[model samples]
Target: MAIAKTSPSIKYSFPPFVPDGARLIILGTLPGEESLRLQQYYAHPRNHFWPLIAALAGKRMPSSFAGRVALLQGNRWALWDVLEGAERIGSSDAAIRNPTPNAFGKFFSKYPDITSVAFNGQKAHDLFRRYVIKPGIVANDRLTAIDLPSSSPLHTIPFEEKLAVWHDRLAPYLPPKPQNRRAK
Candidate 1:
């Protein structure tokens, strides 16, 4: 019998997608399988994240990746993951281990305009509360932090229900809906 060799998979997070004049940072757990492969956040077509954002901000979900990012940045929003890297078998947040949190203290210092942290899911919130907050890298009093419902399709909630909760918590942070301009 021959033994096979296998190495542990260590996935790393991408650089934060923070644009200038950003006021709110939305953090998620590690990218899922499809997202990692696609090299974009919420790449899964089934994910509600982009649609929710579009509906909330009164904008259309753009077709291109750059457009999607610009939409958020234009709205004074930022996006990133809670961990710098982690050892996980797959996309399951529960299976995550050896989590290395991002350098939040440095991030906060560099981006003073960021006044709030909106967690994209419960997993991100728990991880930040444990690794980032417990280590004293960031003080809860320093920023308004809210745990929004997970935008994952696996969450099994109606889109409207999730949108309602998201709107309630994040409307203040999001830019106002665009006004329809009519032809003169």
Candidate 2:
């Protein structure tokens, strides 16, 4: 008898961390094994997501899951993946198969405030365009989508370079810094 070699199917665990005031959403292909095990998006230590986001917010990288969520929500950013579930070999997005995309129609309707979406990688952008955009779901003028480099550590580009691109692209969507008024 021959043994079958194939990746296992996994369902997304954490619901989209979409704060009420979220103006921008960061979308990934799917949570990797480390993220799934830790029950947090971008849980892999080597992943550049936390560092890049922290730099954008002018804060240190958070060491805890709650802190990370605070960073996202505080900045009016949301996090979610393109797929609801998929069969993947390891954490590689290239190995994904039988992908079931999340309900973007319902999600967009529920979160009407989400004006912009940034894809964390090419695969995410491809999946979203093929599954959601091609179907005429995200045709509204209020929403804009941008494709960004993957932060999975698999991409060897310098962190500073990636940060610069993210900062420049995302700056307009992020909330303005609060002005501190001094007592007259």
Write down the lDDT of every candidate, Cα atoms only: 0.89, 0.86
Deviating ranges (above 4 Å) for candidate 1: 1-8, 177-184
Q: List the residue pairs that clash in candidate 2.
A: none
- TM-scores of the models, in the order given: 0.90, 0.91
Worst 10 residues of 2 by lDDT: 5-14
TM-score of 1: 0.90
What number of clashing residue pairs does each candidate have, in the order they appear? Answer: 0, 0
Query: Whose lDDT is greatest here?
Result: 1
- What's the alpha carbon RMSD for model 1? 2.8
Q: Write the per-residue lDDT of candidate 1 for residues 76-129, one digit (tens) a residue.
A: 899999999988876778878899998999999999889899998899999999
